[model samples]
Target: MLIDHFPVLGLRVRTPRLELRYPAPDELAALADLAVEGIHDPDTMPFGNPWTELPPDQLARRVVQRHWKTLSELRPDSWALNLAVFLDGVPVGVQEVEADDFAIQRQVHSESWLGLRHQGQGIGTEMRAAMLHLAFAGLGADEAVSVGYVHNHASLAVSRKLGYAENGIGRGVSRGKLALEQRFRLSREAWQEHRSVEATIEGLEPCLSLLGAGEE
Candidate 1:
């Protein structure tokens, strides 16, 4: 049987050539290896945090730790769902859907990283669209938000493709360094109006309450 905590095991979102899902153990191991191989190079920081500056093994450990922590501390109010992105049956990177005070916030946020080798194939946009489908259609979210470092044009472009409008810019300290972040938001109505990908879900029934919603 699929794991109970993450019924999203069987739940998948597919594009013409990519598949997204919560990784099972074997798949998660493969994903860890992908991270080990390198998602970002040491000198370049696609993410605002300097976390990528860590050695490859450390970076790989961090990826495993995130999955472990999320499952161990599963909660309704705040949670992180990490889906391994696979292209042609091989792990390429991770996509995350997260929320804080989700039971009350009625909102969610998206984040993701594609292995440097897989960066420009339009996979980012489709993966994000799939997450929005789950947030707005599956979880009944009112809005979904995302933030990109001011200089991360590629991420900003993905948000724009999904019809996310600029909310504002804010300053924050990341990895002990100051950074500027550009916030973006998309309402349920806006998502429906602008979405273009075809996404479907399965195995969400048992986990629906975890999302703070009743079956629709």
Candidate 2:
């Protein structure tokens, strides 16, 4: 099985309403379809790269290619785990956690988006909480950080609900205009206190070193 050669592919995180895992090729295709369906308002670009603005064909290709690129380039020192978010066996979106020099800094950053039909339904918070569990409880991370444009209330609210503190503020360009960004940080201590959603990790032990979780 592929998991024998790349154990990270076996990793899974589950919450009451969601399951997050590395997407198989077909699942990745489903995700591409979901992305084409729509992730956000056409007028607003939540991601710094403005990937959502691409045409349907390009967007689908980008989704598949980006996942392939990340998997090909993963290493202990730097990696991004873009877990496909599944709800009731259907692909809904993505919840990603990534780090640079995680063995030393022990910190991870996360970002996510949901299908337009899935937004405002609280699945975002639950899925993010699952990733937090995988990072802190499963991977021994010291802190987790996230950033959102100041106007992105859904993202900001999820961080606040999870007990993240305002870490800093900055300015960046969004869709060609200057935008304010809000950074939030959640330490392990805070995570322990604020954790509410029940979550579990499976197949993480074998993938630890691949994620730089065993370097130190």
Q: What's every prediction's RMSD, in angstroms?
A: 2.0, 1.0
Per-residue lDDT for 1-216 in model 1, tens only? 536645655667676677788776887887777777666655446676665666878877788888788766656777778878888988888888998877777899977888777878898888888888888888889999999877778888989988999999988665567778899999988999899998877776767677665544
Evaluated against the true structure, the overall lDDT of model 2 is 0.92
- Model 2, range 35-95, lDDT digits (tens) per residue? 9999988777788899988899999999999888888888999999989999999989999
Question: Which pairs clash in model 1?
Answer: none
In each prediction, how many residue pairs overlap at the backbone (N, C-alpha, C within less than 3 A)? 0, 0
Winning model by TM-score: 2
Task: List ranges where model 1 is wrong by over 4 Å.
Answer: 41-43, 174-176
